[model samples]
Target chain A: MESDQYYLMRTLKVDLGERSYPIFIGQGLLDQGLMAPYIKGKQVLIVTNETIAPLYLERLISSLPNSLTVDHVVLPDGEQYKNIDQINTIFDALLEKRHNRTTTLVALGGGVIGDMTGFAAACYQRGVDFIQVPTTLLSQVDSSVGGKTGVNHPKGKNMIGAFHQPQCVVIDTDVLNTLAERELSAGMAEVIKYGLIYDEAFLCYLEDHIDGLMGLQPDLLEQAIYRSCEVKAEVVAQDEREAGIRAWLNLGHTFGHAIEAEQGYGAWLHGEAVGAGTMMAADLSCRLGWISESDVKRVESILAAANLPIYPPEQMTSVQFKEHMAVDKKVLDGSIRLVLLKEIGKATVTADFPVELFEQTLSAGDKLGKFI
Target chain B: MESDQYYLMRTLKVDLGERSYPIFIGQGLLDQGLMAPYIKGKQVLIVTNETIAPLYLERLISSLPNSLTVDHVVLPDGEQYKNIDQINTIFDALLEKRHNRTTTLVALGGGVIGDMTGFAAACYQRGVDFIQVPTTLLSQVDSSVGGKTGVNHPKGKNMIGAFHQPQCVVIDTDVLNTLAERELSAGMAEVIKYGLIYDEAFLCYLEDHIDGLMGLQPDLLEQAIYRSCEVKAEVVAQDEREAGIRAWLNLGHTFGHAIEAEQGYGAWLHGEAVGAGTMMAADLSCRLGWISESDVKRVESILAAANLPIYPPEQMTSVQFKEHMAVDKKVLDGSIRLVLLKEIGKATVTADFPVELFEQTLSAGDKLGKFI
Candidate 1:
């Protein structure tokens, strides 16, 4: 059984020259003795939140080398708590424990825990090595694979952050079995995004496997995650700093961020925001003649099947959308540059889209269910 | 005329591949139309402190392209204020004004302001372009050269920071004419450090031209700043993250940081602490038989001539020194690594030095004046 577990392990590389690292995918990876080599020092500081700590913290501790000294900082679980205040807690634990530059921080939770832990590692002692043990499907498929580490700002989501990559990413599909159904659906949104932006067949596969993914089938989930990681890895390797093609990764993020920011961060899971936001993007793309109306219906149907939101929140208005998006990092000079789909598996980052079409989509986005 | 300032400009390059940037040193770079090309967008946020805004901020503003929209966030002036609180003030200004990723933040002040601004830029929008308009001798010669940007933590100096390089460094030496004599002396400590670590010839130049530098002779001051930047640039280019040889730059900083942390930041100017700390490092080096006692004395004399401190504070005990040094970023695992001089112009980073010798130096460090 042990040998079979090890045999199931697959690795994907994110080629960032000297800073490149690997993402390991499998079941039972947390128990397979995989974390020791990546941890270079004698000291380890695992940062997880209250919810995740009770689930996998003990299991993670048992897997580490016995001789290594270990400590943990348990943060409050939620997106609202992901801020500079929480980061200070990690810094306090490290300094109080006298953990030095050689210390390795393990981010062992979902996107919130991983982001805060990765950021803490990035800032602690001017940067220490860290490994990602993503527990949520959202983090495994999206946040954990990218080097984008940051905390949310009141005005925007992920407004304050850094581009510090982890030493390695350890993705164990078994952890997703315990994830909340809402969280599981949220993760599928990003998984579907990879296919929408880069791989058409992958999108079709996700459409077919939505039920299997929702049930947390190990093989189906692992394949989906592996494919999603491959897509992000290719984009990040080409533009480590998000100078050009990397901006494509922000496909639904412009609308998603506005939703998360306006409704308060934790009220809506990041993926729920992205799911609805992607539908809005598709609608805008169709209006621009890049994607057809039928294509938009197909995108909406897939997201609906995954039980993800396919429309903007009722309270959100066109003015509010524009107001929130104006503060986005994607806004260059005074113009908001958006990532819109050209067709299935194709996207373009542009500021040339018509304002009338965008305004029309914003006014009509929440009513897309009637057309579907 | 005005052309002389442009003609006299000296540009030094920090070659870190794609992150490489130039440092321009001259008399009136602010007024010489040097910063416009580097400003990527119409929005420019100039982060200056209270002490510097009245003096050079106006000149910098006038020099910027008129079409550019520029705003200023002047923080309180002091090392004590160089924390997350002040960094938040920059973030507040940027978010309130809706400054996006394309915005360029110009850090115009002493080392404290430059460090905070660079850090703010590093965190704002996950990293934005920042230009260093270093006005202090300490900043122009040292802090502004490498990509080292951060605020100080109460437990340790520079405990919280990121290795975010500036887009360009603009050093206007003319501003130093208004700098206090005390500040000038603080700047010399770093200037003397370059000679101690990398170039014996430069040490001789500083020793011979001490009067010209003290008097703020534009050419002499500019030459010293240029050479110091060159040495720092070379070291940083090879080790941008301070994983190895770059630690040599901390020759005086380890001891200096302990002093600053114990006394509280801003109580002792960073260079003053560094000056006294260098004497301690020299004493420890002599105890290790790495440098002769006379060489230690020579190092002290140069610092004394620059009107800088040559002894650790009297209030600090050897135990207190150890306590603070224990929390330093350089304390790898449990071992305290010190950068020791091999000779007047050579240094090495090692943990092999005798603890008894280090203790002896710490106990007798403040009493070195009697020996000299």
Candidate 2:
């Protein structure tokens, strides 16, 4: 789907040759009057959930030209339903109605629906076309932009899927009206991720306007999504297939996926699980003497105020966590490569830490009560 | 996953950046002894069907490094089982065993299993390492090498999947010993496809040794497979995503997928369906004033001798056929592009043809009575 996307200027990119596209950021992209040329297709599949579908489905569909036949598939809202069974519901609906390859599937919800819908499109007749209309701040910044799509397995989340790119990404800041206070707070964790891993300047901006973001201020939310996507897009362009630098994107995900799988999907929001995982990552780095206590606390302080968990899941045993660690994508030659803090805004991937100490930190940290 | 691959001379590249690898095709590739160097991880998921596992799995597995954990998931034999729900069985098994992202999936059967298993790997955690071990002539020649992996939907065959590349492809010509005569004949259709579309020399070879191939002549099968892989691998290298030229591979699939979807899966092997579809394509070319009378008959005569069908199922009405066409991948702007033969060794993809007359020829040419 060769789309001429007008994304915020960024350093990273998702280079898949003819399929390569940029994730545009900045306000009012739907009103920019530039994306109409790339958006073509007599029929469109605007896939969302009951929660986000009714709120923004009309605006997103109206943004398209009247020549298009926009169809919608609203799913149940939550990460728990992001499984193969749930994804098949989409397949059943598409096939029953006779959806074809050229038909576009626009994912219009949080991380759960976006990932599941994108994966469905990837597998529909070896793949069709799709777009992303992320409503939640978490999706606007992270899940909704990347081509990585899949559903959770009983053993693991995102255990089944493919790398299918979206034709275009339409992020309407106005959709944030439906987002709960807890949802907004949870999404802030990923916003902090971009700064911790890529842009230090963006981190400082969050620190300054942390109050406005906590309240779901439209201007602040848009800026964060734009910057986060810019950083993500740049990284993706250079490493479309996650062979090298793209591994950096999994900074806290290895620990996060483990916690998500262990605690069960929807028990804690993805952002919250990731928030806790990020805290564990900073602690591990401190134990390994990679970063000082101040930087770790700075990371912890941000997550704590955002109402995100700052410790690992208390229900998980060290052995359970260890078993989960073995499945991480970053591990090579049976060794786990961790993306840990070298400073407040810098991180490095390393496998030199003591295994016993790492496990000890994970166990001890989880023993602590939930974030205050 | 980059290995020292020795094809004739070219670099069989997969455009998925660092995840890409060359597909080796030559005599005695199994003994050339390059698998241990390329295949990573100690644990492997060797997926094959009951028909193929007994013939050559021992030889191929023994040749590999002993340090590997090669567990096998044997499926029942047939194209009927290559569906979305069936493919999920593989994922459930992999996840139930706690198989991680680093685990390699070895597809050890023909196109049905290769497509299903490769697709399973593709969706398993958004993708895992996969190696294609094609046993049937059809798979060895085509499906085993290319990165296309998916399962069939009830509405259509291969209606769900992704463009996932295998870590490496292992084609052991020794497994054709157990292939049924009907299957061997069905496989020749694809073998002939490479020649009709790209390599005329290979087509001449098939014409020269029809009986020899039917008798399971080792040298002839190897020559056919090697040549077809060479042509297919070359095409894959040029257009990995099937954007333009790679799509030329689906010469008869536009009609074939519909027939298979209409008649149910196992009732017609994929190759048998393609064989019939190819005949219809030749006739369509004749109707369009593109191919000679004998050229159309030549395709029909040889396919008939090989015990393959030259017509589709008779029960399908024009409307039913058109309804099936709704899900074909070639449809764009709400029109299905039919790939018809311009001559014996040439084909063209166009949507400008008349549909009413085409349906009449298809309905008049039903040959399901022979198989059903």
Candidate 3:
């Protein structure tokens, strides 16, 4: 075991003061026995989806100490299935199994699994402890790091939720080998977002190595995920409850969430909606003279090269977008505040932007899909 | 107005450092226009029960600034209605009214209304501000002061909740004038608990003034409410999350919750269960030699004078008590940790008590209801 191997398995902290925890990212990190210290009690409930349970659940359980009592609840996969019904199922299992407050809930899947499981942990016994075992590229970079845990309501995305941080986040990069290629690219959208929101240099690196990242070149993927987590962790540390700069992370999410809610949650992958939504935000920012038109093109090029959407579903009209975003959780008072890029690296949450430009951005896109 | 009149309307602070807020206990605090400053937004959603809305809702609304947009949701009154479904109803109203993150939720009833409304505010847009306007004696003394907010699941009482502090708590002493006799007695149970858990002198005061409190003498009742809030505020200030000394607050809750869950919530008022539950705990303490049998008798005498139950329901046997309590949220790992009195003024949370002694205590109680 060399020092570089240990360096490759990097530990990043989401510094939320007393509630802070570390994120362990690298290949075969689960098998390296990293999860045991975070497991505070005798009982561990591994909450995973049906899709990932067979592939990685056993490997996770095998890594834990043999003396630990473990049970699992396999939820049906996909974002469409993430709802209060599934949460009820998790609660029912905990009660039936008699898992007490001391039980640690381990979420093993993608963002849906992590969000729902985190919420279940937050609500159970007024809250118990939970650990995130993110398996998807998107979750590894975004959802698994922030303390935002929730399920979408029919009226809006993440309408019912809580800000419950996890005990630790374990990112096993090896698991990405099993993810579908389309899902892989969808995740790159969030990866690209980290650069778009805060790191111009990282954006340049993505542009330079887009091909390698798309191909799942381990080194490139690791760098992208690590840098993305670092950016997210920094923003979250400043504003754990989104009182200020933290909302910058939702650069494309306001428009993206509207698309997901209108199309139904699963029709478009979260990152796909985000990719198209990011393009809209860029166009709006360009119209506002916050960024040059070329910068918008550069964003489109990166997302396009990564095989992501640059437009929402053609069926959604600007009226629908406005209505959906109106009820968005981020809407303070009655105005929908948006995160708009001032340049490649800087983003701002503001309500000062023109409404017509937003409408133009929403109306500008046509139906199209790309694959890496 | 005399100094005594001013004393009747005392404002006590729950010192939680930055999250600290005042608990206003007085006859006409609501009409004094105290709630306006605490309400942060133009919109206020007053969540009250059908039973309470007609009694005091209009008075509350009239006290708010006329420029503010005010709405009320009248839920059917009962502990049974405090669940996720009701939470959804609150959500629906918020959405339908297009209440944004800036909207404030006002809980305008007793514990059930306060807990459910506070939870609604907590889950709405991740969280919104809420104020506690406790109308019952129980709420004025206990639940309204603490930030513990959640709906109940069929499996347990308050099984699904969060620790969301309210902006402020307004206790209109006059509202107790409309409370039913049983409800007032139930509130007295909590009032007595304050003395039992942390203040022996307060317990002695309670013993001396049981007649005045039960008779609803204005000065005596105001004094009791003020002191109970003080004890609760101190406990919560030290341990807001029930990590240690705060567990003492659950002195009767573990056993009380089981009774509420088994009998079905609302079949017995929460304080009614606590009344009997506290006696059971006191008896257990007596058997353990932590407190004398005479001390236990004194506890019984105080509760009896306040018109509360001192034993479990006739239908509930020791086995049922064991089974229901096994699933209590406070059961860490597999052990049921109980908050027991070392003496009337001192309480400790421990799993060290003998199991058979607990069972014997459960079986020792007779089915008798007491009235002042």
Best by lDDT: 1
lDDT-based ranking:
1, 3, 2
Q: Which is better, 2 or 3, measured by TM-score?
A: 3
Q: Residues B1-372, candidate 3: write the lDDT tens digits.
A: 223445347889998888899988877776667878988888999999999988888988888898899988999999889888898889888878888888999999999999999988888878889999999999999899879999888887788899899999988888888899999999999888889999999999999999988888888888999999999999999998888999888888888887887788888899999998998889888888899978988998998898898887877777788888888877886788999999889999999888888877777753443211
In terms of TM-score, the best-performing candidate is 1
Superposed model 2: Cα runs more than 4 Å off: A1-35, A313-316, A369-372, B1-34, B199-201, B314-319, B366-372
Ten residues in a row with the worst lDDT in model 1 chain A?
A: A363-372
Q: Candidate 1 — what's its lDDT?
A: 0.88
Each candidate's clash count: 0, 20, 0
- Please, what are the lDDT tens digits per residue for candidate 3 over residues A30-97? 66668889889999999999899889888888888998999999999999888889999999888888
Which sections of candidate 3 miss by over 4 Å? A1-7, A366-372, B1-8, B366-372
How displaced is residue B179 in candidate 1, in Å?
Answer: 1.0
lDDT tens digits, residue span A282-324, model 2: 8887877777788788888888878888887667787877778
Please say which candidate is ahead in DockQ: 1 or 3.
Answer: 1
Q: List the residue pairs that clash in candidate 3.
A: none
Q: Each model's C-alpha lDDT? A: 0.88, 0.75, 0.87
Q: Each candidate's TM vs. the true structure?
A: 0.97, 0.89, 0.95
